[model samples]
Target chain A: MDILHALIVLANFIIVPAIAYGSQLALGALGITLVVGVLRFSNFAHGETMAFGTMIVILMTWLFTAIGLSIYPLPTALLALPFGIIGCIAIVLLTDKFVYKFYRKAKSTPVVLVMASLGVTFIMNGLIRFIIGPGDQRFADGARFIIKARDFKTMTGFKEGLAIKVTQSITLVTAIIVVAALFWFLNKTRTGKSMRAYSDNEDLALLSGINPERVVMITWIIVAILATVAGTLYGLDKTFKPFTYFQLLLPMFAAAVVGGLGNPVGAIVGGFIIAFSEISFTYAYKKVFTYLLPADWAPTSLVQLLSTDYKFAVSFSILVLVLLFRPTGLFKGQST
Target chain B: MTGGYGTGADILHDCTVAVNKGEIAVIVGPNGAGKSTAMKAIFGMLTMRSGQVSIDGEDITNLSPQDRVAKGMAFVPQNQNIFTSLSVEENLEMGAFLREDDISETMHQVFDLFPILKERRKQAAGELSGGQRQQVAVGRALMTQPKVLMLDEPTAGVSPIVMDELFDRIIDVAKTGISILMVEQNARQALEIADKGYVLVQGENRFTDTGSNLLSDPEVRKSFLGG
Candidate 1:
């Protein structure tokens, strides 16, 4: 292999996918961070919430597809997304009213809220599994690749080529749109200011006449939108399964903590870092790095830092390293 | 007994100081005095075991801090008084969260009162100095257009130079016809501008008189004033 071939392979296989994956993780992490910071609890059920929202979109897509209404060139799920978001918001609001609201009224500690979220998580997990049958579902179709690898090679006349997937483009674009909307809502609006104030100091926020319950409701709604977008994008990129969705908790949390949980921009940055590290470490560098080393020294068995199967371990290790060195994460989140 | 209470840490034991609609009433005490506790009790931040707190003669002894706020009472705590992460403008807006009116006019008035804050309107409240932070806290309380503004040790950590300036602002706020009830660590200075002054010690009233009378009192001067 030559330097040109290696570089192309690295860019095509590692860089592009990492950015899309990071964007997905960032959106999910931001939702988790907000819940923890403002609501003062580590919401264990967030992964399941993402799953639930995506499941709704998948179900809606199936229904729409059956009715002969395809979006064409884009996944029909894209059209079903708004309805999915609404469903997610309703579910979250209802959960807050019945479950979390009681704990809040009693002034329960954050740990208790964490436990409550765990219970909610289990319930949502069970509900999704029962309804969606806990199986991998391929709901995305119609123009799966923006540029096929064969097409890329033909176009460029290079030994290596660049390929972009339709799902990957959707992931990047959707993440950008969602993040921009979120920041705008948080920084430039009255209710958004109230939410930040409430997050900063709940007692003072109350004294300032902010309705805590209302802020919580709004927070849940925003979280629902982010979760739906994240989940759908992830499913579109990969395959959707209830079990896999539930298992995403570790990476999502790692992303949030690495980015400095509760800091929005930090979560985004953290997501990219985690995604890139996972990909770069697991990527079989024999194809990419064989070009750089001497022929004898390069005699290797897939020079990879870790197996792809251990992706979760990578996230956990990074999370532990971050916590040990910088307990507040990359950003100085709420010490209060 | 203090503020009419016979036992316990009754900071305002048997004490009754009224603002009378538009007067500045200052409460002065030693370091261990219950001045702040009394204010907290009045504002419903502390539970009153047995005392009546009223506003315009309506009983509000059991109201929460939020309820008290709704009933036209505003309190500025001595510490952590404002949302530090929020911008100066946001902090002021929070003060008027319950008001449905267009508070841009009130915000303008607040800016005029504290011109420095106006220059740093977009800056976070946490970045401000002690005196400026105190101004934000006070300005937030004023947004409610309350009948009475209760302040807890407004000059506690402020520099002496800034303390005098803050006092001047307080006096100016008093002229706006809002009743002022302040707990002061700087007893002499606080009493000087006060329409009525109450001296408390060990959770009980030590002296009650006009500001000049209390300032000149031989006993008050010996204990709280370091005379």
Candidate 2:
């Protein structure tokens, strides 16, 4: 019974949160990986893109709430997701059209593109702040828990109860669906193969008769979708704060680089790895040890490797280590 | 033909080369002799400042490379010719990108030409041996059902045995009524299979004749055949 209680605490503090966070990071990393792989640049604007999209979703959610319109037990934000995605698509397409296209035509270096994207980052950040202001906004309105702790205790008669949040379950399910659909599109479609070929060798792809503009348009559209979905989900799981989204760039980039930048599979695995490490390293394991150890054997310390305040630092440290040792990342991605 | 990279001076002079249906035309010269340049000009890769390129009586000089592909022309470049990360089958599918019709028949034909490719159809092209990669490159070009196939040094960086096998495959491809235009470094072996041979020197065609005639010509033999 004690062991069961300890496991419940561990699940509530580490496993559940890690999985939810991992899913969000996975989606964000996928966006980064796709842009890096296809567009051949590290887009510093990604986090801003997410914030911008999520801001639109929040606005729509508030508008729906004001009109007394909602999906009820589910958040009305779900209904507004499409609008957010469309807005994001418009912004990304316009950015590509007005900015990146010229540099692409000039055949600028990747660093030049990266610097250009940083410029986009600032503009988008300012735009999002100007529209929404920099503050935390909570929009989640669904049935809060799939399984309540009290209900679980009544059913199982355990010393400790387990509670699973509805948002956590939704995050996992949506991530699975989105990832499966993306993989299918990439592997099974003709356009997807062309994109892959284009990413592999640009000149050869042109010789094979692939239109450069079409590939670019498709890439932007996909990135927009990914960015919007990831941003909305993160906002729903936590509170929507513009600055928080900006800071998310670190973990997202860390996930992409750690998994092997530009590798879709690597992005996912790296997300989970970073999430679990962040959670476990900061989580206080004293309760867990108390339940597992003999009465007198429990440790006195909180048994936390690091404080939650340093979570981003964990991602940064891991990224630096990965870069120092395995520059191509764990999956041996393209050297670019 | 006369053209060069960007605004630079022409790398190719008044060079002209062609092949009839089911014929193999080989272009041979030293490095920097514009052997590849002449072929690029014909394939619409470079702007021909003073020449026109026509295929099957259709003037295609103004068409983009993609447009040229639609007109039944395929070109295999000398380097980075294959999508290294893609599977052998996927590479061939990309070759048929413009075709809306069913391509299974053409894919099977490609497999038949390069049986090793068929065996490793799911393998990434990069993982294949150099010889097999060359086969994939040619096989990919064939997927378009092209009327004219252009190859740029298709046998580069391959073993002698692989080179011989590649030449045999090229010959087989030509036998199917596809005109084969190729630039080669191995002048002697290339000439052995050429129906038409153009010997380029300093970006100009020095000799144009039947492959056998070029092989027997005293001037061609002394200058290019390493006699």
Candidate 3:
């Protein structure tokens, strides 16, 4: 019974949040990997892309609320997601045309493209902040809990209660559906195969009659959808603050690099690895240990490896270690 | 043909080579002889300073490489030709990308030509041996049902045995009534199978004749063929 209680406590604090956060990170990392693989640059503006999408979704959600629109038990933001995606697509396409395309035409190096993306990052950051006023926005309007703690305790007849949030469940289910759909599209469709071919060998893809412009357009559209979905889900789970999304660039890139940059499967596995590490390390595990150890033998300390405030440090350390030891990352993706 | 990379001086000067339908044309020369350059010029890879490339009497000099593919032209480059990350079947599928009709018949045909490829159809091209990778490259180009197949050093970096096998396969492909245009480093062997051969010297056509004629010529043998 003590063991069961310990497991429940672990689930309540660590497992659930890690899965949700991992899903968000996976989606974010996918966007980064796709751009890096196809467009051949690390897009510093991706976080801004997410923040801008979330800002659009937030505005649309408020409008929907003003018009007395509600999904009842579900968040109204879900309905506005498509609009946010479209807005994000437009902005990304515009950036490609005005900024990245010129550099691509000039055949600039990847470093130059990275610098150009940083410039885009500043512009998008300013735009998002100017429009949204850079404050925390909690727009989640839904049944907040799929499984309440009181109900779980009552049903299980246990001292430890397991609570699952509605958003957390939605995040897991949505992530599964989205990830499955993405893999299916990439593996099965003609355009998807061409995209893979383009990524594999750009010159060969052209010689095979693939239109580079079309491939680029499709990639940006997919990235927009991914970024919007991920950003909105993260917002629903936590809070929508522009700065928070901007800061997310760290863990997101870490996830991409650790999973092997430019490899989609690696990005996903890397996401969960980073998320679980961050959560498990920061979580005070004295309770779980107390359940397993005799009271006299148990330590008085919190048994937390690190505080939540230093969460990004964990990501940074892992990123550095991975870069130093295995530069190709876990999946041995393209070195360039 | 006369062209060079991006506003540079012409590498090829009045270099002309052609292959009739159902025939094999081979280009042979020493290193830096502009053999590959002439092939690229015909494939629309580089902008020609002054030249006319025609396929079945239709001018194709102005066409882009993609447009050339639409016009029933397929080229297999010497290096990095196949989609390395994709499976052999997927690589072949990408070959027929522009086609609107069913391609299973074409795919089966490719598999039949390269039986080993069929056995390892699910394997990634990058994992294959050098000779097998060349087969995938050729099979991918054939997926378009091309009228003219152009190859740039198809047997490069392979063992002599593999080279002979690749030449045998090239003969089989030519037997299917598609005209083949190829540049080869194995000058004598290439000429043996070629219906027509051109020996390029310093980007200029020094010898253009029937394959047997070039092979039997004393001057050609002493200079280019290394007698």
The model with the greatest DockQ is 3
DockQ class, candidate 1: medium
Q: Scoring model 1 with DockQ, what do you get?
A: 0.76
Lowest lDDT 10-residue stretch of candidate 3 chain B: B1-10
By lDDT, who's the top model here? Answer: 3
The collision pairs in model 3 are none
- Which scores greater on TM-score, model 1 or model 3? 3
Q: How many Å off is the CA of A11 in candidate 3?
A: 1.6
- How big is the positional error of residue A232 in model 3, measured in Å on the Cα after superposition? 0.4
Candidate 1: segments with Cα more than 4 A from true spot: A1-4, A292-299, B1-13, B57-59
Interface RMSD of 2: 0.8
- Single out the weakest 10-residue window by summed lDDT for candidate 3 chain A: A327-336
- lDDT of candidate 1 over B36-76, digit per residue (tens): 87787777766455668899999987788898999988989
- The superposed Cα distance between candidate 2 and the true structure at residue A134, in angstroms, equals 0.5
Candidate that beats the other on lDDT, 1 or 2, i.e. the better one: 2
- Span of ten consecutive residues with least summed lDDT in model 2 chain A: A327-336
lDDT of 1 by residue, A1-336 (tens): 478878889989899999999999999999999998788888889899999999999999999988999878999989999999999999999999999999998999999999999999989988998999888999997788999888989998887888999999999999998999998998888899899989988888888789988899899999999999999999999989988877888899998999887888888998998999989889888877677776677846888889999988999999999988887888777432
